[model samples]
Target chain A: MQMTKQEYSKLVDKKSPPSKKLKNCIFAFLIGGAICTLGQLLMLLYEKAGLSETQVKMAVPVTLIFLACVATGFKVFDSIALIAGAGTLVPITGFANAVLSPAIEFKSEGHVMGIGAKMFSIAGPVLVFGLTAGVVYGLVLSIFRLF
Target chain B: MPQRTGHTLMLPSKPSVTGYAAVVGKKEGEGPLAQWFDKINEDTTVGESSWEKAESALVRDALALALDKSNNPPSAIDYLFAGDLLNQCTGTAFGLRDYNIPYVGMYGACSTMALTLAQAAIYVDSGAAQKCAAATSSHFCSAERQFRQPLEYGGQRPPTSQWTVTGAGAAIVENAGPGPYISAVTLGKMVDYGIKDANNMGAAMAPAAADTIKTYFEDTNTSPNDYDLILTGDLARIGSDLLYELLGRENINIRDKHNDCGLMIFDLKKQKVNAGASGCGCAATVLCSYVFEQLRQRSLRNILFCATGALMSTTTSQQGESIPSVAHLLNITI
Candidate 1:
């Protein structure tokens, strides 16, 4: 009826299925690479259209995120995510899903509290720190440019 | 420790399930068992501002339908045994607050339905109450937010992950109603089989289900084949397979009539649910809607409903703690 934590752990470990680490790793690698390649293709297409470097940089992410949102709306992205695992999480689309899904799910809750508030739930921290880093880089660059 | 036989509790008087109701969200409504459920809310929000409120409304809608179907006024109910996959069972307390009946909130995670029914049966059999209500609810959004990642996170679910059934089920048991009766109940003991993967709940809970069902068969001296149907809650595919193998080793072949609410609640082939449907409502909805309909009509008999639960908190799982799971079995017969 009673046992040490170690004993209990042993009991649980004895019954659990063995992990397929090699298979999981291979899938994560392949999928992660694919998602990144898709993002790169958007950038390449923007470059071919003779867009300015700044416009291309902005347009690429916007297209990738929009595609991710569309795939999520169609319920196809989650299917890809099922197999890709870390590959999905590592890509920008994964972040897009994080921002879009909750907002969409809680859409009925109203804009202020639902979309406005929850849209930033998972990706908020990333946005905050990322923007802050960008601002810091811009400020340092501007100061050097002036010098 | 006299080998702990006779753990089974036979009723003093036959307890009958007089009324029941099941409700779910649109996703579950799209499942194969859609037609069987009493009601399905088209939107996950249920016209509520927050996920918690939506869950409370699910319990409210389900209990209202159950009480209405039973043809009993709210005042006729003696006590309400209710719970949900929420902290302190807040969903239960909040959902049923409008009702003046005495309430007893319980928590067995996903196993709340069977646990409540078993207790409600015992109370009725003991003449503690002429009519008692047993209810439980779970919302996908609420449970996901509480137990795992917020749906807003849109986290990638593992193949082992199960979709939580966003619904509520309510049933009223009485002494002098209908033919199908609660004959016996076998409460399970907490068993930790050291499964640490929070994503793979079926694996974590399979051993506990095996242990409970095995002990139930041993104590009652009943064979699996003797029952027309045996159902386990929320084990889905993986856990159900393990259960089959566990029982098979003992020469108990239940493949002919065995069902998992998880697998039954959703059409895994068509639905994206990798493992199957889960949550407290998983068993509650399937059993209350489909199973109860069958039993009430005398289409089938000798049903063993065992609801399984994975008892772990966010903190515990985050701390790398192994899951402790349990199952409660209620033998229903006509």
Candidate 2:
């Protein structure tokens, strides 16, 4: 017989208890916002590095992957994520972080099949989309004489 | 694999006229034993391997009860769709293999039960098979032994801890049922929180539940008020509250009808289930014993059981990465 907190709460009828609800929400909000802010900071760094718009876009993902790899190596990302909720996942940083994290951890198995292949596991969709979008953009530019 | 090609069979099962089924494992006079694993501490003498076997035994019995009540021969079932917390699906495969039913192994963490049930219902509804049994099993001892270490290997559980339940549950869905039928299902969105601790799966699964619940309402055009109960697999105490807050933001007030199986299964004071148990078996056993029984008695008209899972790997966990979660919704009309 599985029981829930609500049922337990009802059984005891203990009102005016510490609110676990508020704590979790605030915890998720603050940490999640912090992660996004960090991404913004990275973006600023990319611009200050004197990179062009295209280069900055590319570098941002690279930086995210690197940061995620380091975080994963240090084993800190998941702990922070437990508090932040979706705040860690919504940004482009999350995608890059996911891709690189797996590659670095799997490196122990082998290089060719392990690090090389697994690193792109999560990023495969991004590459497909980027290539498809690039081709579409190129075709449109050629037709419109924009590039 | 028995592949039968024929016309689609749509059972005109109304939500109001369908009967339901249920099964529980703990024998009579064995009070509160079904969830004994939640109370197990790091210093317990029980070996992890033994716990795994015990968990498997419970699940096997529960599954047999569900199958017996459904009145379907084990051989007539098309596939045994199942999963568990153990590496390589040890409990599900071992507990059910002897029945000689074709197995379609799946892994979606704790949310596996609803995912399997939803898929099983689809097979029956689409005329893919006359009967398909979708079942999942989980054991805290087995999970702890495999994922972490033996219970006797005392270790401090962090604040984000969620106790794994030692239990197993199964459900049978048939095409010619004159009972509760699965109406629709909603798969959860993959959501990640940068929390790297493997101890707290409940928190990891919250966003997945929020995503699926929101999607279910949007897709089905059904509000939380429409169902008698809106249950989540193993969100436990913390995750359940998290889900409530998330849903509240969307103006989907489900506090009154919503519940978590992890939190509901034991006496927290006497048993002292730290955090709460969230696994494949948690929700499976609850649905089979509590929810389905209510449906059979016509005490509840409709139910939306949303099982949630954290799709994380040991490598990902050791790498200090956040967990990605998925949730699946099974709408049962009685």
Candidate 3:
């Protein structure tokens, strides 16, 4: 009862089981590698179909996004992600699922305010920071080139 | 007559549990305590279009079942204390809207079950009402969308993370009946041990649970051995251990007599619920069905049911404030 918040948190940390980081890493690596290989296969297939390099490059991600959206709709993505950990999450498909899920979830709240607004609830930070970083990097490169 | 003993109130009027019912979704129906529930809807949504509606439907079904079992019409109930793990307790409000009962909306998070029961018993014991009802619910989908993530969002849960139960429970309490009575209650103090992790709710809630249980025991001059069971709401694996450790620090051992509703409701290993089941429904369903059945059958004589809740919103967690938790205790006996 006399224990401070710091002391109690320490006790909680000591008592609570740690996440299986190494196991998760291994699973993530294997599953993520598989997804990348599949993407490569899709690219090779697109190239064989006589598509331009740029078209193949664009086609691969679109295909991956389509598949991810379907999986999200079918509600099987989370099951796979459970075992896959960051495997499913680090890919483009993960971003697609992240966007699509909230849209589907908030569909009941109506389209404009619910789906449109909340579609980016989870992935909004990534886009904002991603674009910001890109702009900053481009600015930094231009500044260096001016010399 | 109601008598105050320290922080606990002894309900000498014996607010009797006349009827109790639990309604659960598909996942809960597949769980270990499935047989105990009154209704097990194979559809998680309960044929409702949205997750929020499903949760409301669960609350409605649970209350209807309890009322039917009580052999009392809705008009007979004087007051209804109900809540759920939803924004503004909308699940309870919408669910019971058609019932036309005088409603007292509660917000105890997962601890809403015990909180409602305590309030209902107090109302009955104080002669404010001849009959009252306590009800609460939580939907996995609704809870996830509100508190965590969208249903299809792929994210791994931490080991200490709990699965919110998609269920509801209701109990009708009367001034007198063939008794499994509400004998006493110990209202908890808000206790925060500076636990900031939202995923690790057990850690956030354990201190309050330990505090309330200790207070109840001290107030009643009773020990862990005095009760057949010391039931905690949703302190799953980690929180339950922390509670035992906290109590043991004061040389009060409840490990032998303790059983958490979280642990009892789900088969952790097979269900893959990480720590255990949580949410208001976790405790509510287990208590209304299994515990109530045991009490009625005279299998368990006395129980100290303490339901703990992590009183933190997503906004509070994002604001870096620690989860302040409360646990409300009820002394239920046959």
Candidate 4:
């Protein structure tokens, strides 16, 4: 009861079972690479379809996001995400999942309150700072051009 | 050992668990304790349009089933103690509204089940309430959207994360009944071990569970061998192991007689639940179904049921704060 913070922390720290980091890293790398490779294949397919470069670039992420949403609806994304972690999370699909998961879960709360309000709960902070930075950079560029 | 042990209330009046009910959704129905549950509905909608309403329905039907099983009318009950994994405990508020009984809405997160049992025992013991019902519920859809991720999102679960059980359970305690009686109770204290990650709830709750278990043993002058089983609520695989280690360090071995509600209700291998099942209903469904059955058949006697809860909200998690948790215990004898 009188234990110091360090002692209490040490005790709590030891409570978590040891995880297989090396094995996990390998899985993350392999799965992440596989997803990226699939993305590349999609990009190639779109490019070979006589689409413009801009269209192909846009189609790749949109396709991936669509696929991620589909996989999530099927409940198969968690297994893949489990292995690839950042490989899935660092990509656009991760953001899609971040939005989609909570939205569908709270669909019972109604669209406006549940989906609309919480749609950005996960990614809102990132969006806020990202948009702010973009506006600041745009202003700086415009100021330089004026000078 | 005398009934009045350390930090525990000894009920000399002999209150009993007269009736109980368990209602679970599809996934829980497919779990290991499928047959033990009183009602298993594939349609989680429960004739309702919304998930929140469906959750309310789950509790209402569970309380009704329990009263029917006990052959007691709703009007006969004196008090109703209930809670759920919902904002403002609205799940219980809306669900039990039609019951028309004096209600005490509580929120102990996952630990609400045992907390209710302990509180009910106190009332029944002192002759304040002749018959009282305690219920707790959790819906997978409701809890996920509120606490974690969206249901349809392809987000990966951390190795330490647990599945929130979609279920509800209710129990009736009476002053005179032919059932398992409440012998004692050991209340838990809030314990924070500085764990900030919300995904690893088992770790956050294990310390409180350990403290409560140790205190119960010390107070009752009993050990692992004294009871047929020592059950902890919703700790699952990781938290259960942590509890084992912590108790071992304290030199009180419970590994032999210890079990967890999270691990009991589901087959981890088949369910693919990362750590195990959690939520307020985790302990409720297990206790009302499986544990109650065993106690009914006289196969188990002098069992300890301790439900644990994580006291953290989305607001706290966003602010980068540690999860504070508590565990409440009940000593039941058949």
User: iRMS of every model, one decimal?
Assistant: 5.2, 14.3, 1.0, 3.3
The numbered model that scores best in lDDT is 3
Using TM-score as the measure, the top candidate is 3
- Each model's chain A TM-score: 0.78, 0.55, 0.96, 0.83
Whole-model lDDT, candidate 1? 0.84
User: Candidates ranked by DockQ, best first?
Assistant: 3, 4, 1, 2
CAPRI tier for the interface of model 1: acceptable
Could you give candidate 4's per-residue lDDT for residues B1-334 as a string of tens digits? 2156678888887688999999999999999899999999888777788778888888898899989888899999999999998999999999999888999999999999999888888888988889999999999877876787666655556678889888899999999898789889888999998878888898889889989988988887889898999999999988888787667778888888989999988888798888899998899999998998899999998899999999999999989999999999999998
List the TM values for chain B, per candidate: 0.96, 0.85, 0.99, 0.98
Off by over 4 Å in 2: A1-147, B1-49
Error of 3 at B123 (Å): 1.1
Superposition TM-score, candidate 4 onto the true structure: 0.90
Model 1, C-alpha of B319: deviation from truth (Å): 0.5
Q: Which ten residues in a row have the lowest lDDT in candidate 1 chain A?
A: A1-10
Report residue B99 deviation for candidate 3 (angstroms): 0.7
Sorted on TM-score, best first, the list reads 3, 4, 1, 2
Candidate 1 regions with alpha-carbon error over 4 angstroms = A1-59, A62-88, A99-147, B1-5, B152-155, B249-251
Candidate 4 ranges beyond 4 A from true positions: A1-5, A18-35, A38-48, A69-84, A132-147, B1-5
> Would candidate 2 be rated incorrect, acceptable, medium or high by CAPRI criteria?
incorrect
